[model samples]
Target: MTPPVASLWRRLLDWWPRIARILTLAVSIVVVVLLVKLGRGIDWREVFLAARGISGPTLWAAGALALSGYAAYSGIDYLARRFLNHAQTIWKTLAIAAASYAFNVNFGVLLGSVGVRLRLYRTLGLRHAATAGVVLFGSVTNWLGYCWMGGIFFFGAVPRTLAAWGIRPEATRAAGAVLLLVACAYMFLCATAARRRWTFRGHPLAFPSVWMALAQSGLAVVSWNIVALILYLLLERQVSYPDVLGITLLSSVAALVAHVPGGLGVTEVVFVDALSGQLGAHEVLGAVLMYRVLYQWVPLCVALPGYLAVELRARHASCGAGGHDLPEEPYER
Candidate 1:
């Protein structure tokens, strides 16, 4: 090949990943814009009135709860490290946590937590395989919490409510049956992995004590539920906590099933539909959108600069420049 042609080909190869990221970002931006536009002509006055009705105390209390949720989220990795017996520091974990969440919210599964972990693995001194294992176990733990929270309402509340809503009891029963089978399959996989003594680079999975794990998961669900309630309170005058919790939990589960990026329209639709009898369509939509913006984007906005700082420092250190010494390998799966 000619020298110029070969040089151009190498340059393209090097730029490919960056190009792909840019494309993904562009698509996400377009999706958000389209969804917002689709739900236009919203009554701003009602939204503003609802916002005004949200008591100052409630807002403050909700904010505090939301912050606690963030703490719990950061602790996910902390517990994972403790369980895995990795000697990683908290600061590194904090940065990776921020990056992973920001990426997951914006980019969905393609650039989910796994991607964030992969990018920050160097600082953690983990290889790809080890990092994958860490991410997998963390994901499983997180999902267990999600299921635990959903099951509470699903069994105790959803079934009764669905019947009241005129949904056939047999339909709910069928759904439960399907979910049971799925859960069994998942448990089988985890058990199989456990039996194999699978470890990324032999870093044994230290399963967190069941009680502690349950507590962590429970706190996570409550924190998130508070976030959801805050949105409803800000956008509607009358919504009981139990109602909000039930609606939020069920809708969240459904949105996950739809698998849309950040569950975008899917979540909003579910919220509005569930609350239709009590809330005007526009009011619910507005409330959900506002909450989505605040809960979903605000944290990432706060974390972005910190993540960038970490990345820059890691790069400089690796080049033997101004950055501090840090490991380059990531955990293996």
Candidate 2:
């Protein structure tokens, strides 16, 4: 409580945001380097041949699965809105959710997704608190679903994958147990502390009801599974579904931890490392490339124009209304 100590703490708090940004940038660079090193051995000729050999029907199926996956992901936003008791048409929510996710997958969540969501929600007339609530709810739901599915998959169905990764079966099970425990803890909190609110650094945090959490988790699981299915279809179903599921889960976790843009190289590196023996490196690389185009690039192409149109309309409205722009709101640090 002394003046000198208080001054030191205040200075540290002021520098925290800059420090965090620096750390994130450094980590992203490291991940990109690792990805390049991991991909050095891949044969592009084979990769291209594999891509070219993919049947039209298979490509169509993968595209359909990709669409379904994004649609399921949009449900996260819908559930978040419900949790916050915000009223918006499902169509509008879906539009924002799809566009934001497309941006997030390409540009990273912190830089693009959150900003897009905040702006879109504000333009839709929600206050800052509601926007933050929606973002928090969506993030929690994603983690909850990941833990639930990952715990189940790693604990029982994919011991071979653990062995391949040089992880002992016992250790893998223990890790799985830890994941399950974290998910269970969240559910317990929701059940018993639904009305509880906590303040952290001047921001209020609230828990959704148990049923809402369950719904959120379910939707996330569906979205993730659909994504796995897309990859499986792209690979011509050569690999077993369980193996694909495990690999997808590992890659997803790695990309999330790396915080790299679009998880670009992180995912491909993990996939190649994990499934090299099960499938040819070039074939796997090709399938991954195709999957990215459908899931990330295609969505991004659609989202960018939609976002611009929205911005243009907003600008025109502001100009018409006495030529003043809307006030900018500060996003959560």
What are the runs in model 2 whose C-alpha is more than 4 Å off? 1-39, 194-204, 325-333
Compute the lDDT for candidate 1.
0.62
Residue-pair clash count for candidate 1: 14
Top-lDDT candidate index: 2
In order, candidate lDDTs are 0.62, 0.81
lDDT of 1 at 296: 67
TM-score of 1: 0.69
Count of backbone clashes for each model?
14, 0
lDDT against true structure, model 2 = 0.81
